[model samples]
Target: MKKKVVPYLLVSPYIIHFLIFIAFPVIFSIVLTFHKWNIISPMEYTGFANYIRLFQDTLFLKSIINTLIFLVIHIPLQIIVALFLAEVLNQKIFLRGFFRAAFFLPVVVSGVVVTILWQQLYGFDTGLLNKILVTLGFGKVGWLIDPKIAMPSIAIMATWKNVGLYIVLFLVGLQTVPKHYYEAADLEGATHWQKFFKITLPMINPTIFLVVILSTVGGFSLFIEPYILTGGGPLNSTLSAVLYIYKQAFFYYHMGYSATLGLFFALIILSVVIIQKKFIEREV
Candidate 1:
């Protein structure tokens, strides 16, 4: 009895913390999804009203569509760029460590700071990109302010910010591939591309799958870039699901509806991830 009690005592803090923070919030949010409540008001049972309204909400639908658009653009670009960088870093080169650090620096930076920096770079008139374009005899492009370009611009910035972590993931995966396989391929006079396709890619399928799932989830949870850079604007073109939830909860004081949105978003993410896992596992 003493030994068992002592072990439970040792783990009590973690158990208490989990109950207070994680478990409680999740359960409470689920409850809230079926009721209506503002922060200061008594809860009112609303059944599936919030859920029904969510489907009818144009902004909510737009946010979901915008998030999907971001995923479509961000995931492929992230995988390709990160894979390329990882391959480059795997080679023997001068200042290799320096280059790796440089690429990863943005990941360590604050999200707000990164967003602000890009906001400046995406400014219409004096932006660095447009300045260069103007100098090269082209018209200035609206990166963040134009509805047609805002979401894609945010997606590109997001890819740049997060690709470094995936590069390191890919680099580790690349290092794990047995060198003897490469040597055997070289002995057969296989070109670099041929060896990569035949050996490296197949061996690193798990890593590719991981990167895809992580990037997909991250894309769905997007809020900061659109929040800071575009404010979900230029005709709500950059509005993300999470940002819309934030607005509903805090900005509009619709706590119950926000909880419903959060729950639905979680389900959507889970469904997409399940489908992705099946597809990727089959291929791998």
Candidate 2:
């Protein structure tokens, strides 16, 4: 009896913490999704109204589309760039450790600071990039101000910010390939491209899948970059799903509606991940 009681006592702290914090908040949010609350008033039960309204919310739909667009550009770009960098780093190179650290430095830096830095870089009139363009006989491009270009610009910035972590992941994947596979390919007179396609890619398929899923999740969570850089403008082009949900929750104080949006968005992520898992698993 003492042994049994001691075990429960030992684990009680973490169990209590999980229930009070994570479990309670999650259950509360789910319940809140079925009601209307503005933080000041009592919760007013609305059943499925919040869910129904979410589907018809054109702006929220647009934000989801905006996030998908970001993923379309970001995922491929990230995979290609990170894989190329990983391959290069895997080769014997000068100052390899320094290069690795430099690439990853932006990832560890604060997101707000990175956004602010990119904001300056994207400035139309006086940005360093624009200054360079002016010197090279080109007109200044609005990196964030233009509606059509803003989301793409944000995607590019996001790729730059997160590519280093992917680089390291790819590096680990690249290293795990058997050295003798490359040796056999060499003996068979296989070209670099042939070896890469046949051996390297297949070997790294799992890594590719992981990167895709992670990139998708990160792309969907895009908020700080656009929030700071464009404020979800110049005409709502950069409004991400997360940002729209954030605005609904805080700016508009639609507490219940925000909870509904959160739940809906979670379902979207789960669906996307499941589809990816099925497709990639088939390929594997």
* Cα TM-score per model: 0.95, 0.95
Which segments of candidate 2 are over 4 A away from where they belong? none
RMSD of each: 1.5, 1.5
Candidate 2 least-lDDT 10 residues: 217-226
Model 2, residue 68: C-alpha shift (Å): 1.1
Name the weakest run of 10 consecutive residues (lDDT summed) in model 1. 216-225
